[model samples]
Target: MNIQNVTVIGAGSMGHQIAMLSALAGFDTNIHDVNEEVLKQARHKLNKIMDKWVGKDKISMEERDRAFEKLYFTTDLEEAARHADLVIEAVIEKLDVKQDVFEKLDKAAPDHAGLATNSSTIVSSLIADVTSRPDKVCNMHFFFPPLVMDCVEVVKGEHTSEETARLAMDVCKRMNRTAVLLQKEISGFIANRILFAIQKEAMALYEDGYADFKDIDKITRKALSHPIGPFELMDLSGIDVGYYVMLQQYAETGDPKDKPSKTLVDKVEAGELGKKTGKGFYDYHSRI
Candidate 1:
């Protein structure tokens, strides 16, 4: 597709990193956020991160300057999407909000431009119908910490055409990400589905009084050789995010078991959203 301009909606954790990666890959990247404060924060955070990379000799100062030059930020959504060859929506994980953004992008972006979402679980088919170019819409799910995560899931929704999927894969390649192709759409995709089951079982063990949460984390790390424990991982990813994802899954399947654990719900209600909030399953306030 020879994508040149990449637009990333939302300046949150994922969106900023995705835009930075796109710029690093030599694509002119535009990042849009409705909130001006968020755009400022993203710009500051990205600059700090790039400086750190340069200090560590991971990227040269010239490379960092070039990347920063290619990056642009704005509060205007249409302005960001106007001439974008690829629009990757990384907004909040609400179906209605995503549908609204996609609908507008369909009109604002050029007809030949491809549309994609960075949603972890929500399928493009569920939102594609609202847009005129359903064939161009697909899921390009990037993992958390987009800068470090090398794998991107390229999911093909029912209405998504083969050419669109291939173009998304190519886009991932251009961003220096390895694209994992999913032939069919599924909730939680592959990695999250497996991790969800493990977390469910871990929570069950803790709730059943078989082990302490910390012990379970220790066991998983020691026995399974995982870098982080389930609870700690939840803390990193934010309990509120997991809570909403579980609620979305339950809403879709109408199954009580799909609901989030009481522990997660309680933490979220207490306003302990995880690293961002300085508290989750663990306390980050003291350490940080």
Candidate 2:
């Protein structure tokens, strides 16, 4: 399917950047959020990011201006989805919230518009049944901070049609990102599943007093050659996000082992959600 217009349902960390990428790809992009303040902030953040990109010579001023011209922010979901040929939902990672959005998107979007979720763990199969066009619902999981990440995971749900998956892959290509197509749906998909295993082990080691979280992170970085330690990565991605993902995983499998760790629970309860909030596994107040 030919996609010209794109809509991103949410104005949070992931949604705003995804909308920017769509606009940069020459698509008429609309970013919608229930909170008008969030829409305003997203617009401001996008401008700052684009300015930085221009300064770094990643994009020319003319190209950035053109992208801004095509990008729009709205508080109305119906208005955002109306002209969209594709809608990527990047809302909070709660199944019920996503299903609610997908149901509404089903009614608001055009008949041919493909609906995708940018969920890292929640599979599209669990969300597709809520929409009338289950075959058009697929997972287009973009990594955190879409601007720097070049890879997208395109997952085909049980009811998702081949055409819908192809459309998502094509859209990713247009946005100058690599797409990895998964023939079958799976919880946590590829990268996250591997990352989760490492995180789980790290958490266990920390919780068991085998080593301090900082030391574990240092070992991983120095010995394993990882770009960052698991704890640092969790902080970068938001501790609350990992907490919710763990909750979702436990809910799905009824396995106690999948439950969120005590450290994660405490961090979330304390409202220290990493770089965005200036605290998580590490303090970011000084840098901020």
Candidate 3:
């Protein structure tokens, strides 16, 4: 279960956070992406976070230096996964793309190494089917803010081994994440399912003309103690991303309730995609 080197196969927000946390937790973390620009951005983002940690006295200079030192950057996927004790795929949330990646990992990953998917909603079974060694594959879904969030959903594929799950759980522990093993993979896993259910109701309320966006958000913050409302979370997470997930949910569950709101579709179409683009349910691009 002990790991020295971990390879994160994508250098997006979650992947970068995973790389930083893994390195901070004493693993030689390697991050790889197809694009060089993304790799550079990931390093920049992690360095900024680490600087903030140092300023807050949350991490010592030695620890920060060690984290930066332990992290290796790469653009070559095969080379990065070759010697890694564990490989975590955090690429786009597409089943075929993920399956393609895992098929390669089946060849590249070490025999004893574990393979995990950071897929938020895609079924682990589908991903494992494409993997030659399904027994070594499982879902290790970390939330948006990997460094700050503690919950790591350890989803077990039907054919996934207990040993593999144990090792994956141990890996989460090393990264200081709370690992909760789900006996089976359900659509949206645990957190997302609960989250979307609430979202469905909210959307219904807004669509039925019972409430407006700001009022719903204000009520949730004041009454539910939720820092951000579902709409706000969707904006931060990317409206298009949330819309795609809702579509996937509808396709899987055959429930109309899982369908996303028209406002989300319109916003995405208008290219007003949440925080990344600086606007969605709100605007941030102006820095006003």
Q: Which is the leading candidate under lDDT? A: 2
Kindly list the per-residue Cα lDDT of model 3 for residues 142-249, writing each as its tens digit.
Answer: 998898888999999898999999988998888888999999878899899888878878877888999997799989999999999988888777787788887777
RMSD to truth, every model: 0.9, 0.7, 1.4
TM-score, candidate 2, is 0.99
Residue 234 CA error for candidate 1 (Å)?
A: 0.8
**All candidates: TM-score:** 0.98, 0.99, 0.96
Of 2 and 3, which scores higher on lDDT? 2
**Which rank order by lDDT, best down to worst?**
2, 1, 3
Q: What is the per-residue lDDT of model 1 for residues 193-237, given as tens digits with 9 covering 90 to 100?
A: 999999999999999999999999999999999999999999888
Residue pairs with colliding backbones in model 3 are none
Output the number of the TM-score-best candidate.
2
Decide which is better by TM-score, 1 or 2: 2
- lDDT string, candidate 2, 52-140, tens digits: 99999999999999999999889999999999999999999999999999999999999999999999999998999988899999999
Q: Candidates ranked by TM-score, best first?
A: 2, 1, 3
lDDT of 3: 0.87
Count backbone clashes in candidate 3: 0
C-alpha local distance difference test of each model: 0.93, 0.96, 0.87
